[model samples]
Target: MNILGLSCFYHDAAAVLLQDGDLVAAAEEERFSRVKHDHGFPKHAISYCLSEGGITAQDIDYVVFYEKPLLKFERILSSTLGTYPMSWGVFRESMITWFNDKLWIKGQILGELGIETEKLLFVEHHLSHAASTFFASPYKEAAILTVDGVGEWTTTTIGKATADWDGSGENKIDLLNEIRYPHSLGLLYSAFTAFLGFRVNNGEYKVMGMAPYGKPTRIEDVHKVIRVAADGSFDLDMDYFSFHRSTNRAFSSKFEQLFGEPRVHDSVFYTPTTHPNGDHPDWDRDVAAINQNYADIAASIQAVTEDTLLKMCENAYDTTGSNNLCLAGGVALNSVANGRIMRESSFDSVFVQPAPGDSGGALGAALYAHHVLLGNKRKFVQEHAYLGKQYTADEIKNTLDNAGIYYKHFDNDDVMAESMASDLNEGKVISVARGRFEWGPRALGNRSILADPRRDEMKEIVNTKIKFREPFRPFAPAILERFASDYYQLSDAEKLYPLRYMLAVYPTKDDKGSNIPAVTHFGGTGRVQTVRNEWNTLYHSVIEKFWEKTGVPVVLNTSFNLRGEPIVNTPSDAISTFSRSGIDSLYLGNYLIKK
Candidate 1:
């Protein structure tokens, strides 16, 4: 059976194709369209999935959408009506969007793909998130938790899933409880994200990364905005937030009074007045103080989020009586909180789907339709994230030749890995665009910028010289799976799956981690990716070769794109990014290019 799943008209639009309960191809629209967080119908992504699966729209047996339009519209209408005169502007704007696009999603699907109305179906938003993690996980039974911004009036859900064999195996998911809209943990975080001079949704990670640098002294003030019960249920003080009543701002005037004036969007981020070497001549004392204040706010919100999520996880454990947990939703992308939950929560094992955001909703929708709705047995588990498109060596060479780029070609995989490893050892930043691109926000190994993690300066060099982003944001370490336990303090290393996807942080051993300062953050923790040979042999071999030369067994890895761009998709996209960025070498398939 060919199942086509779609998530669009919201951020991170994507398409997924499932053949016989196995995910064949999945990709986000932004990669193909080169538009960050594209919210239109994922025509390009849908086309790519169909082409990748070698099937047409006519061949698809079922078409499932990520969420229900009617229910979501109801939530929007009711919230606006509840706010009354204050929400008039938001109501008008929302109605325009709903009438033009959201309300007609079913018809739009039919018109776009020529599919019959009967073949199209819709799943609840949080259920899509739940199914995405539970079904894709390697667990027969687990406690499920899904948290995100408002999804059809529900913001958070705790459920239990069990695989039962009744002649055929089927995974059954029952939502035990939920937290409703306008009182969401996600929107609260986003409000702070916007208030901290960052874009909502886009800059939440920036807040997480910036937290380690400051103290959480303002957490008491943040308590006024959100109230959490012992059971982990929480409610937001609507008076301080304007998301339900306005489109212009997320936080109200009272919020500014609670915290000081909001940071301007164009202002500079934190920079220390005195460098480690000596006093910097051009350092501004006032700007430094402002940046420190912003950092404190970031830390405070991060602490509150972690505490709230911990309470939720504990409640899920208490309600379900299960040790295994499956976590999904955009908020699950917060690695710092995830690490805390892993260590501090009652659950022993946690499974987080790589694309926990809306993009993964496409995959979840198809999996739910196939395994849950159609009564199919649970058989497939997502072992790796290389589900996107891959180009052959000839195809890559064609792009390089057409672009008139100076390059060298190698026939052997070992030689290519060794060559790239050598360049990395020399402290040269190399961008690799080989094999299929990653399915989620993180660029694992295939499409990644690699550097020597042993050097402390490599982090700043990559951030400023290559990525051209914030200097404080830390890079992740891609370590061989065999050596992960040697470096990280993995309590349950045998069963942990979050590290495979870089979904959680782990404290590094003082003895081993001190040798690699680039990937280690200020708090002695790192978002580590444990790479197995079975997952991506070439990429693993590169790290293995680097280890053989340097004895570090790790390399610094970041997404293979400049700031404000999605990871490279096609070979031509790789060439374009390589040409403009400070990347020293480009390794495309078996060919290599030196700038």
Candidate 2:
């Protein structure tokens, strides 16, 4: 049976297609629309998934939404009532938006596809997150944790899964327990994201990047202001935060008064000359220090989160005594903290969805419907991330032709690889848009801008020469998996988290002066993406080509986009980004374009 998964009416609206429990394709709507964090109806993404899967809307047996509408409505209604007159304006605005857009979401689905409402099903927010992990995982039964900005009523949950396939033995799922909302790790992080100069939902990463630069000098003040309960549970002082009622967040006037002053995003990233020491620090070194500091905060908060999760896991493990663990939610995306949980926590093995954020919720909801609700089970494994629409040679050629672009097509893969490798050796930046688009946030070389990492100035070249974004932000190294451990101390190889997609940062051999100095970040860590040949032949072959040409097995790989945009999802998006950026060449499928 074919299942259609959807996460809509929310930021990063996305769609995923699953056939007999195996994911066929998944995509975020922002890539197609060119609207970063586009949260409207995912018509473009849905169509792409359907076309890629070679199925129509009518062919889908299950249509599942990521979150439960009723549960969320209840949370808003209750919270508004609890606040009463003090929250009338907030309540009115929220209710109006819900009434105008969200309440009729099912109708929107129907209107978009002409499907019956009966065919549509709703999964609770956190459950969808859990399913994304467990369903995609190799483990049969494992501890589960889901944390994100309030999803319906659940902000975080810890649970377990068991044999849950259907009577036909085609599909299956099972769960244990959950934690309700008004408390969220993601919310706390987002609150801090706002407190910093970055945008709330989108710029939490900037805060993560920036944290590695400053001394956690404000830690004592923060600890006092943000009180931790006896059980390791903490609550933000409501007076400092405004997310529930107003969008301004914790960085209000009172917040500025508390702190010396809010650092403006555009201005402050450069000027704070003296760190807590007498040393001269560039962005990476300074940021590295800050990363260590943030890692401590992340480690501290994550310690509490893991402690709660461990208790929850132990309860579930005792009942099931299962050796596996699965996780979802935005918090699942925290890889540094995840490394700690994996090393120190309760589970023998763990599984986290690569797209553990809300985008994966769509896949979870659909899989849950097919396996749990429909009573069918089929063992599935997503060994690779090439589960999105791919352009054929002709399609790519046609796009380039229509655009009046300069181009070249190689006679053989070997020649193409060598030439591209030569370009990189000469420090030429190339935009690669080959094969299918990636399902998650990572570019994974398919939609990546490849560069040489040996040259120290290449990072600046990528920033000023191509991306034109913040100069300090470093690029990731797409290294061959065989060399992952040689380069990074990525714990266990067999069950290693897929660094192939560039999630977590690992310390280099020389923290300050690593081999790939260009890709290594301010914090002396590289967010590495390990590539095995079997997963993506074209990308791997090109990397091999570069290696053969330059004797360097790694290339500086960042998402094939400039600042403030989603990764290119189509040939059109690829071309547009290529035209805008200072990339030296473009590789769209078999077609290559040159300046």
Candidate 3:
């Protein structure tokens, strides 16, 4: 049976196809459309899934959407009523847009695909988040926890999953309990993201990365704004926030006054006079101290999120007695937190689906509908993330020829990897576009700019020379999976599914980190991508090539995109990215473009 799952009308819109309980393909709309964080309907992605699954719309046995639109709309309207005149403007603006497009999600999707509306089923937002985590995880039975911005009514939920022989061998996600919205870790981060002169939803990672640089000298101020209860639960100080009050946000004028400033826009960093680096010295010890403080605050946030979440996980574990734990949701994207919980949590093992964010919601919603809702017992386990499209030499050559572009093909894959690895060893920056696109926010090795971590200037060269982004931000290293435990304290790596994306950081294990000046962060941590040989052979081969040349066994890898752009998708996209940016050379498929 063919099942189609969708998540749209929100950021990171996507679709996933499943056949007989196995996920066939998943793609984010932003990648296909080249729009960063595109929230529109994922028509391109849906079409790609349908085509890749080799089935027309009618062949799809079920259509599952990530969230219940009507329920979410009800939440929006009720919140508006609760705030009354204070939030009326936000209500008006939000309602207009919903009426204009978002509210008709089922109609829009069915109309676009020419499918019957009756085939569609709406899953609760956070339940979809939970299912996406549990079902895709390696664990057949595990405790589940999910946290994200308000979805329908749930902001955070804890559940349990068990393999049921209930007449047939099938797994079911059973709910335990939840923490609802108006109070959320994601919202807290987003609020601070707005406070820090960054875009709220998109820029939260910037805040996480930037926090390592700023002192939480403002922690007391944050406390005054966000009250913590004795029960280990918390509530927003309400007076300091405006998001619930007006489209403006939940913060108040009085809140900003205590915090010392309002958020800064991205454009301000572009201007000569207000350039971010020019304003602050590259490495102020105070800034370094601040960065450390933010890491601790990140520590605190992770601590609290885990503390509250464990309450649910332990409950699920005790009830199910499952030795494994499965995690998903936007919060599951927190690698640092995941690492900590792995060390401290009660579960014997854990599995995190690589695309744990909303992008993976498409996969989860579809799998839930296929196996659980449809009563199909076929069990499908995902082994890797190389499920996207791949191209051959002829296809790539044709694309280049159609574009009237210049290129050269390599005689052997090893020679290309060796030559590029040699250049990296000598400190030359090279952009790699060798394999199929990765599924999530990370580039993996396929669409990444690589550099030598030992070269003091390599990070700056890749950032300023190629990416054209903030100088303070650090890049991740794609390390061989075999070498990860020796470098990082990933003792439970067996429990966690492989993470090709640089989503999380692990402290160096000598158990201490080395003086790899470029890749290691100020906090003595590095975001490492563990690449196995089976999943991405060529990309892993290139890393092995770098190791042979430099003996470091690691290469600095950042996403292959100009600032404010999505990762390159097609061959044309790769070429345009190469020509437009300061990338010295780009290895596209079997060919290389050297400038």
Candidate 4:
């Protein structure tokens, strides 16, 4: 049976196609629309998935949405009533949006796909997050955890899953418990994100990146806003937060008073000019003090978040008594926290899907519908992030030729890899677009900008010249899997699968990592993707060639996009970005382009 899964009308809209329990294709709407977070109907993504599966809308046997709308509406209605006059403005605005757009998801699906209403199905939001991880994981039985911004009524869930024995056997998931709305770990982090002069959802990672630079001096102040228990369950003071009552603000007056003043958005980051103890005349303590303060708050929140997550994982372990654990949802994307969980938690094995956020919920919804609801046995393993649509050689060539772009064609893969390896060794930044685009927020080998990780200045060059992103934001490393441990300190090489998708951060070897300054952060950790040849051939070969040339098996790798843009999906998008940016060369399939 063919199942179509959709998650949309929220950030990271996406569609997934599953044919006989196999994930055939998945793509995010933002990739096609050129919007960073397209939260509208995923028409383009749906179209691409259908085309990739070689089927029409009528061919789909079941259509499953990622969440239950009416249930979510109920939560909103209750919260609004509970808060009453304080919630009036938000409640009024929410009702109008829901009535006009959200409540009509059924109609939208029916109208868009020309399918019968009976064929459509809905899964609880957190269930989709849990199913996405547990079902996609290699473990037959594992403890499941899902945490994100409020989903319907649940902000977090702890569950258990058992795989089906065969096509006729029983497959099941039991949700042991859940934490409800207005007390979300995601929203708590997002509140800090906004207060730290970053966009809420978009800038949470920035806070994570900035944390390692400073001490967690404000941790005590941060605890005033929320309280945590020994078992990881927690509650927000509510008096310190305004998200429950107002759309315009996330934190309240009490929160501001506790943390002093919020940072002004888009202001310059601060650092002290001299040590306060030493007599250094003409040092600007006034100018440098606030930046250090901002970094300290970032560090404090990151510490609290990691501490809370570790508690949650321990509680999950104690409850389920399972050595294997599966984690999903937006909060799971915190690589630093994930590293801490892996190192500090009782679970021996942990699995997080490539797209752990809402985008992956589409796949989870479909898997949940097929395996749990339909009683079908599991058969697929999501081994790589190449599940999105890919362009054929002809399609890429046509786009390049039609654009009148200057180009050179390589005779074969060997020559292309060798050429690129030479460019990277010479410190030339190059954006690569080959095979399918990655499915998640990370860019694996296929859609990445690569540079020599060994060069100290490579970070500044790529950030300013190509990415146009923040200078402080460190790049990730795409390292050959066999050589990953040489540069990174992995606890267990046997359970290093999470590193394949850049889902975990690892401490860089002190002697080895300092040699590759571009990828290693100031905290001495690197978000690394371990590339195995079987998963991606050309990518592995190029890295191998680079290793041969420089004896360093890692490259400073980042998403192939400019700041505020989604990773390029089509050949045209690649050419457009290449032409506009300061990248040294564009590797589009076997062909190359230069100014």
Query: lDDT of each prediction vs. the true structure?
Result: 0.90, 0.73, 0.73, 0.89
Off by over 4 Å in 4: 165-169, 273-284, 491-494
Which residue ranges in model 2 land beyond 4 Å of their true spot?
164-177, 225-232, 250-254, 265-268, 271-322, 511-513
Candidate 4 lDDT over 1-595, as tens digits, reads 8899999876689999999999989989999998888989999999999999999999989999999999999999999889999999999999999999999999999999999988899998999999999888888899998999888999999998889756544678888989999889999999999899999889999999889877999888888887999999998999999899998789999999898789998666645522335233434667567778888899999999999999999999999989999999999999999988887899999999888999999999999999989988888878888988889888988887887777899879989999999999998999899998889899998889999999998988898788888777889999989888788887555466678899898898889888899999986899988988899998999999999988999988999999989999888988889888989999998899976
TM-score-wise, the better of 1 and 3 is 1
lDDT of 3 by residue, 375-411 (tens): 6664566666766665678888998888887777899
* TM-score ranking, high to low: 1, 4, 3, 2
Top candidate (TM-score): 1
Candidate 2 C-alpha lDDT tens digits along 44-133: 999998998888898877789999887789999998777678677778988999999998888888788878878888998888888887
Q: Provide backbone clash counts, one per model.
A: 0, 22, 17, 1
Better of 1 and 2 by TM-score: 1
Model 1: per-residue Cα lDDT over 1-595, one tens digit each? 9999899887799999999888889999999899998878999989988998899999989999999989999999999999989999999999999999899999889999998988998998999999889989988889999999878888999999987444445578999999999999999999999998889979999889878877899999999999989988999998899999998899999999999999888366764521333244545777777878888899999999999999999999999999999999999999988988998999878999999999888988998899888988877889999988899878988888888888899989999999989999999999999888889899999999999999999988998888899778899999998888899998546467888888899999989878999999987999989898999999999999999999989999999988888899999999889888889999998898999
Total backbone clashes of candidate 3, pairs 3 or more residues apart or in separate chains:
17
Candidate 1 accuracy as lDDT: 0.90
- Model 2, residue 282: C-alpha shift (Å): 14
